[model samples]
Target: MIKYFVMGLRGFFLLAAKIWSFVCYCFKRQARTVIQHQTVRYEVIQLSPLSKHRLSMLKRKTLVLDLDETLIHSHHDGVLKPTVKPGTPPDFVLKVNIDRHPVRFFVHKRPHVDYFLEIVSQWYDLVVFTASMEIYGAAVADKLDNNKGILRRRYYRQHCHLAEGSYTKDLCDICSDLSSIFILDNSPVAYRNYQDNAIPIRSWFSDPTDTALLCLLPMLDALRFCNDVRSVLSRNLHLHRT
Candidate 1:
C-alpha cells in the first residue's frame, strides 16, 4: 500500500511540472507577437506622404549626371577611334580635342539612353557633372547634345576643387532649392556627401552592347514625380533616417 501511494505522488509532481512549463511558453510567445505588432505599426506611421504637389514636382524636373564611366567608356588599351560606315562622306569624321590633343569622338549611346533621355527631357532639366577635364568633358557633352539634346549644363574638372574632395558637395550650394536637385553618379564616395540631394547610380560604360540604361527610366520617373525631399523621407523615414 505504501509503495502504491509513493508512485501516485511521483506522477502528480510530473503533471504539475508539465503544466508550469506550458504556461511559461505561452507567455513568451505572446510577448514576441506584441513586439512584432508594435514594430509594424511604427513602420507604417513613418512612411506617410507629405503633399501631392511636391510629389508631382519632383517627378517633373532636374537630373544631374556623372560623365566619365556613367556616359562614356574610357579604355585602358588606348583612346577610342570613331567608327564610320561604308557609303558615308569621306570627310564625315567626328572631331574632338582633349587637353589640346585632337582625339577621335565616337557616339557610344547606351541601349535605351536615347529613348530614356527623350522622355525625361520633356519634363526635367538635365545637367552633366564630371571630374574629367573640360576639353574631354565638353566633347562628351557635345555628343550627348547632338544626339539627345539633353545636356543643358556641364560641370567639368575645373569647377571642382580636387584637394578637399568635399568640394563636390558644393553643387548643392548652387541649387536654389534642395528639393529640385538630383544627382546620379557611380562613386559612393561622392554621393555620400550629397545623400540628401543625390541619387547614386552604377556606372554604365560606353559599350554599344551594354543595356543597363533602361533600368534608370523608372528611377528618373520617380525623381520627376518627387517635388520635395521631405515627401520622399516621410514615406521612407524609417528606412532613411539615422
Candidate 2:
C-alpha cells in the first residue's frame, strides 16, 4: 500500500512540473510579443509628422507590382479600351481580320500612368507580378518600359495555381516578408491574398486616364513615414553592418 501511494505522489509531482513549465513558457512568449508590439507602436506614435520635423526613414529595398489591369489595361480581346465618364467619348469598335475571321478590338491607356510611374521608380526597386502568360506579359512590359522602366522580373500565372477564379495560397507563401516590400494591383481578389503588404488600386478600365496617382499618393506618404521610423530604430539598435 505504501509503495502504491508513493508512486501516485511521484506521478502527481511529474504532472504538476509539466504544467508549471508550460505556463512559464507561455508567459515568456506572451511577454516578448507584448514588448515588440509596444516598441513598434510607440515608435510609430513618436514619429508623427506634427511631433517631429523629420520623417521616419525605412530600409525598404524592394517593390513588387502587378502588371495587367494594374500598370496598364490589357484585355484578352487585345483591344485598347478607354475609361471615361458619361458625356465622354462613346464606345466604338474596330474589326481586324485574324485567320480570316473579323475580330473587334477596344482598349486605351490609363491617364497619368507615365507621370506616376516615372516618379515612383525614383523611390523604390520595382518588379512586376502578373497572372498572364509570359508571352503576353512580356509584350505589355515592353510597351510600359518607357514609363515604368525595365521590369527586373516578371512572375507569370504558372508561378501560382488557379482555383475558382482565384490563385491558391502559394502567392502569399512566396512573398512572406513584409519588410520593404509592396505589391500594387487592381484586382481586389488577387490583392486580398497579400493585403497585409499589398496596395489595391481600383480598376481604371472605363476611364483610361490616370487618376490613380491621387489615391496612391497617401499610401506612398505612409510608406515614407514607415521608412523614416525604421531608420531611426535601426540606428539606435546598431542594426547596420557597415
Q: Candidate 1, residues 126-193: lDDT per residue as tens digits?
A: 88888777776777677667765578688877776554555353456446676777676666555455
Residue-wise C-alpha lDDT for candidate 2, range 13-110, written one tens digit per residue: 99999999999999998886565334111112334576244432445445667765666654434434434343444233334455666555333455
User: Each model's C-alpha lDDT?
Assistant: 0.59, 0.56
Candidate 1, residue 161: how far the Cα is off, in Å:
2.6
Against the true structure, candidate 1 has what lDDT? 0.59
Residue 15, candidate 2: Cα error in Å is 99
Candidate 2: lDDT over CA atoms? 0.56
Off by over 4 Å in 2: 1-57, 76-107, 147-149, 168-176, 208-210, 227-242
Report the number of the highest-lDDT candidate. 1
Which stretches in model 1 have alpha-carbon errors above 4 Å? 1-60, 76-100, 105-107, 147-149, 164-169, 206-209, 230-242
TM-score of each: 0.58, 0.54
